[model samples]
Target chain A: MDSLTSPVKSAHPEGTAYGTVLDADVALRFSTLDAEYEAIRERAALLDLSGERIIEITGDAASAFAQRVLARDVEYLTAERCMTSLVLAEDGTAVDQVVVWGRETGLLLESSVGGGTRLLEHLKANADAGVEITDRTAEFALFGLEGPYAWGVVGRLIDGELAALPFESVVDTQWDGVDIVFARTGVTGEYGYKVLVPAESAEQLWTKAMEQAVPAGQEAVELAMLEVRQPVMRHEAGEGVDVLEMGAGWLVDITKEEFIGRDAVMAAFEAAAERRTVGFSGGDTVPAAGTPVTVDGEQIGEVVHAVHSIGLGSALGLLRLPPDLAAAGLKLTVGDTEVTTLTSPYVTPKSWSTPII
Target chain B: MTLEDLRAAAALRQQTCAQIKKMIVSRLDLPIEPAWITDDQPLFGRGLELDSLDVLELYVAIEAEFGVALYDSDMSVFGSVSRLADHVNPALAPSA
Candidate 1:
């Protein structure tokens, strides 16, 4: 690959009306897919994910305590694979979502930002169960890798072939001889990975990945892939849905074990999910995630993910709607803008999923 | 108005010390007596383990109580109960 093949910059940038990405707090932190691509293809880009919370569970009974508390089976999780689970309130409302990783001695729970303190208190309350809970977020650095060049760069430092690594699995591997946990799961829904390394090693990993990717000519994967991965979840591959929409349903074996939210999912299952997750493509401008999904000016549900797709030259979104309103060709209003409903797997991977050559 | 006057005005918004205490306590859901929280003591730091959520709720409560929206620049007012009273004092009535 040469500089011509891998452009130095993606078409989008921040603070522009054409293609912008804002986070939950309404901060224009991420630019459009083009900006992300330029960052990936040419130089090093950094994203402040300090928003991710971490929980540490130690003590003699940590494993047993987790097996009983989480919605997923922790007993089957080995040192190599990580499991995602939800800690539910008594009413089964999702209080916090956690990614549990097993170490040789104990378990680490990477929790979401909103409920970090509450989840820590809950974990500590299982006192007699002998769980020593602590928050270690300040102690580590979280970074992500995307773009076609990501594998070549990370694989050089790490021992494993990240390309062959299955998604949603956690491997405790060494990068440049430093022990790091590279998770296959990513928010961008691309062939990417997240690495949690010691704070001291962060700069080293960042510098190394940059040196490799720029020369390889692969740019950062586009935000468009985020929408594409949603439909890929339903493609009839290994229990495909991502956790955003009831993918946890396929994770927890109701018959094999008892877990939190089992009863809630079963109860909701018989009645059908009140809302179904769907894909939408609309005007050139994309709405924020929390924007209401509506049709005929009637509010229906909320948007989860939305982004400007350079591939389709329009806005795309992963939205949730009531079963009756989720049919293809059904029109809906995303905020003040109108969007047309589309089939699942909304964008084919050929052009949208990868950089258009 | 003087800081004391604003403190008094903010206090006037509270029907009773018990009511304010209950509002704070219920949000924390901690096992503490209403009498334990005096009007002057810090509602954070060593005395109260008020986490970030509690801090947000406190902002909302202050807004609702004083009818004033807290801005990012107003963070200094949230440093302590005393500071909050000082900030609200100019617009508040006495504790009577």
Candidate 2:
């Protein structure tokens, strides 16, 4: 399993910063974090999502297999729709978060950045009769446009009418006469869209899109995602961490009677939750994962992850605390500095207020 | 603050969140259990898939249930269960 690299990496700016996230080497910053972050928060950002692998599941039993594997029910997912779901291990641990794209043939699971190898392995190990999983990464390239004004970019680059399509809407459309799969999906609580174009024309599409929007790197994208509390699976999912503890229960549809990890998830849900995840912000120094969260010098939890939040102008991160202490507006200590447990969406997304015109 | 004090404060916020989640599920006629909704999950478009109509229902339900009039508040109040909890119970919101 070689590490994945962006197909458009050659076209990135000269000073781009690249880093490894799981199995992919991604652009951490194209110019500066501030510039790219501004693009995603204020204007539109062009994202080269080549780090994510696209795996197509097709065959006689594709539907049933997808229903059994995904934490969410996709039984009725038509080719006109797409959705996000968690691929959970049998014990309720998260293998990877994926975007399930409904296609005419079957379904495509777009793995979280750098998470494709593990997700591919998991699907194959569980492969049953009537299922054929194929790695289609070499055939197509995926790119994303996201921001409060990302819809405007869609209007400029593709179709003006497609800008206002319903969220999670999917359409097999065209770009510069090149057939592509377009979807109205977003990660940062913004008006986002994705285009799946042929590998040969990906660089050309990326170049054309770069004209309408700024090329944002992984750092900016992930930061905006954090501000909205979108689960960054690579950062949040840890060993012995269940969906409940990771605060990702919403990704799993517990009512679904049967699925991998259902029993373990149900047991955790039925019994008392030992610990729950909550958001916190404080201090100038970003605390490291495993940093002690204390009250009156008594440790009660640890930092799951943290980073200097450009939006908040301070450290922003998640804390895994006792269920009783997981709520917001509490004064606690994170690695010797007092931090405030705040509500979800530490920063409000502009897309909520902005509309496609 | 002491651990006991923190626990008491967290309990207050958690109680408020539980109430909000229950209200949302009941008013929206959502099929899943109220407890299934996490405190941090988004309430619009993506996570819960609540639309503008759902928001209107929640506004009325919230006014009647929690006695908080959020008609003028921005949509961010409905960003998450915990976020709505802060508005319904301002004591849980960080002091400005």
Weakest lDDT window of 10 consecutive positions for candidate 2 chain A: A4-13
Candidate 1 chain A minimal-lDDT segment of 10 residues: A1-10
DockQ of 1: 0.01
Q: Give the alpha carbon lDDT tens digit for every residue of A1-357 in model 1.
A: 011110112311225222111111111234444665454433333333334556777788888778766866688787777766666544444556677877777788875533456567666664445777777766776666654345554556564476457556778778888888877654333345677888666666656654554311111233433433322221211222223243234333344356555566556555554655556788987788679976455677877666776655688766766544543344567898877654323433321134312
Note each model's CA RMSD in angstroms. 22.3, 1.0
TM-score of chain B of 1: 0.55
Candidate 2 regions off by >4 Å? none
The regions of model 1 sitting more than 4 angstroms off are: A1-33, A37-49, A113-115, A125-128, A160-163, A166-171, A213-226, A229-253, A287-307, A333-338, A347-357, B1-96
Question: For residues A1-357, could you state the per-residue lDDT of candidate 2 as single tens digits?
Answer: 999988888888899999999999999999999999999999999998989999999999999999999999999999999999999999999999999999999999999999999999999999989999999987898999999999999999999999999999999989999999999998988789999999999989899999999999999999899999999999999898999899899899887889999999988989998999999999999999999998877889999988889889999999999998888888889987999988889999898888789
Q: What local distance difference test score does each model get?
A: 0.52, 0.92
- Model 2 chain B, poorest ten-residue lDDT window? B87-96
